[model samples]
Target: MSAARLASASAATAHQRQWFADLHQEVAAGGDLALVNADAPQEIFRAMGIPYVVNQWWSSIVTAKRRAQDYLGLLRERGYPDDSEQYSSIPLASAFDPDPANAPWGGLPRPTIVLAETTGDASRKIFDIWDTQPGVSFYPLESAAENDVPARWWELMPRDWERAVGSDRLDLMTGELEGLIRFLEQTTGRVFSETRFAEVMDLVNEQQEWNRRTRDLIARARPCPLPVNDSIPSVMIPQWHRGTTWARDAARAFHDEVAERVSTGAAVCSEERARLMWIGRGLWFDLDFYRRFEQSHGAVFVWSMYLAIAADGYLRYGGDPLRALAARFAAFSDQLYTPPWSAEWYVKEARHHGVDGVVHLVSEDARGSYFTTRALEAAGIPVLELHADNVDARSADGDALTRTVGDWLDRRVRAGD
Candidate 1:
């Protein structure tokens, strides 16, 4: 039997559905909306009262609804590469979904403006396509390279952000943020307020702090009180709404729920024998896969980047809220996907969670997966690498992947036992 779902996770999912429905209605009634990348500075939009939808979050919804292929095919029919950066490109293709009524969520309303950071060639090309649409204007930000490599970034990011992100990099991002503010002000005819932005920043920090507390609670709980499937929605839905009081309270409530579960010795798998860490984006198409091993091999996936990154990646505590916000995104991808930084954090989390093994789903678009595997192995934690797209399900064979993991667990993870 599957473990009972967390009440917090259920509530978060319900709230997201209602929120999206309201956004859809508002857009239908002639309200403007922004479609932004996951790494874009969303708090600015929040403070300005501009309703925005994250490209990645929407892509996940499309994938979950099994409409990813239909949209991706729309790209191929138009001579666009169907396989490149599917996570970022899927939603763009959905715009051409011949029948809007058949599209997921009644189709993402035609965005008035689209925002993205030019993180790579394919993503730039994808967002550029959005700009060509009649009513959509695209604004791209330059992704600055990380000049200074820091160690234990999570330790320094909250307060010592200047050192965590470097002064020069922060300057570039801060300037770009100012330009973005100007563009929004001109486009929406609403003045930007520094005081309001600072308040939004504070709420985001509070939300992340509660996430940190919950992560620590889960890490120290031996039996793993909450499943990774449950934790993903409970933490990430609120994360998308990071600058709101409701988001902050939702995070705290999740923490308290986990605390209660841990105190009561609640376990996702009562026969839990091996703890595993999932080291990539979620398999939105097959979340049930996380639970498949629990019944057969007694392996419960205890960690994912969703809650862990929220805990460690989003906090910035300095006087200048704009620069602090800039610091948050300046090297955001670097700290998560680059060597040394990602490798170090994965090892730290593996050790802290006491994971017996790791199932690292290495997406084609992500970097440094091999380094992460090497680091975990060096730390004496076995890793099973599975190459698959987290958002695109067309190429993945669920049965084959399951058998591969089952065999690996028997040979490598549970071998000594």
Candidate 2:
């Protein structure tokens, strides 16, 4: 069967176009804009009524529009490695592009504030490059990994986050978040409201609950009620707007749509043979490539980190919303990229989803990919390790990777079936 597409997905795309138009208009009228990293506390901006764009989201736009190669080329021309965190740094390079027609969304406006967590030495250097612009001020938060790796972090993090992640890490993150609040207040002349931020936290929790419902529904559905392609934007576009009522409503709407599809017995592939799990950032340039496997070999990709992480990663409940938000960002990178925590969660998800094979896209900048592959293989799951950059399409060979997957499915996945 042809892959089932969601109307909500197209609606999300239209909503983003309108959002960018408004953002550009705001900046043209002398409004200050912020360019933030994905792990930054976006609720602070949302509560303060400041318009911000996530760097990863903008990079996805650049990659989807097929401009990542050109942007990276400009970086390479300027003496930076084209392969180094290209997704996070693409928008920065695009700002230097003389041609607006060649840039994504007519180019990103000069940001008044650039916020990013110091995930590593490379990330700090990338944000520092942004600080070189005349008026751009950089704010870097410290990201500390947990020394004690906990099992089932998705379950522990919502309520017992303090135990799952250490207090020392939380202390540093909370301090940084306070500094960030003061910095934003000082820069924008907008007072950070405790009441408003608290309310925003409530809205975010509501949105997460809706995502949890959607994820649970999809997990129990045998053939998979929706395609991973549509679900990515459906969950993520609103995710970038996380603290608003609109984002919460969008989450609920997507959940309802998925429930309705499951009720009608909808399936992305009519003959669902092998269920595949994709573990990494999305392949933004080739989302259609996800569907190509279905027609050729009765294989359907049922899982991606977008919906799963949105479901399990963002929930934090406590009295102090700011500290709670800090806890969320503090261990966010570790839970996804670090050793035992990362490896354990993937195995749990693969088993729960009944995944037949795994496609692990290993990032060069992170650790634990080897452990993840070994653990999955030890668990009796066949693993296909693809060394490629999801954001930098030039570094990845889609045709060759697809062929590799086809061969793996035939030998390992389908052979057992």
Per-candidate RMSD, Å: 1.2, 1.3
**Model 2: residues >4 Å from true position, as ranges?**
1-3
Which candidate's TM-score is highest?
A: 1
Q: Can you write out model 1's per-residue Cα lDDT over 1-417, one digit (the tens) per residue?
A: 234789999999999989988998999998889999988999999999999999999899999998888888999999999999999998898678778876777788889989999988998999899999988889899988765788898899999989878898889999999999999998878788988899999999999999999999999997888789889999989988989999999999999999999888899999999999999888988888999998899999999999999999998887689999999998888878888888999999888889999999988787989899999999999999999998788767999999999999999999988
Q: What's the lDDT for all of these models? A: 0.90, 0.87
For candidate 1, the clash count comes to 0
Number of backbone collisions per candidate, in order? Answer: 0, 0
Write out the backbone clash pairs for model 2: none
**What tens-digit string does per-residue lDDT give for candidate 2 at 328-400?**
8888877777778888888988998889999998867647898989989999999998888888776678899
**Pairs with backbone N, CA or C atoms under 3 Å apart (clashes), candidate 1:** none
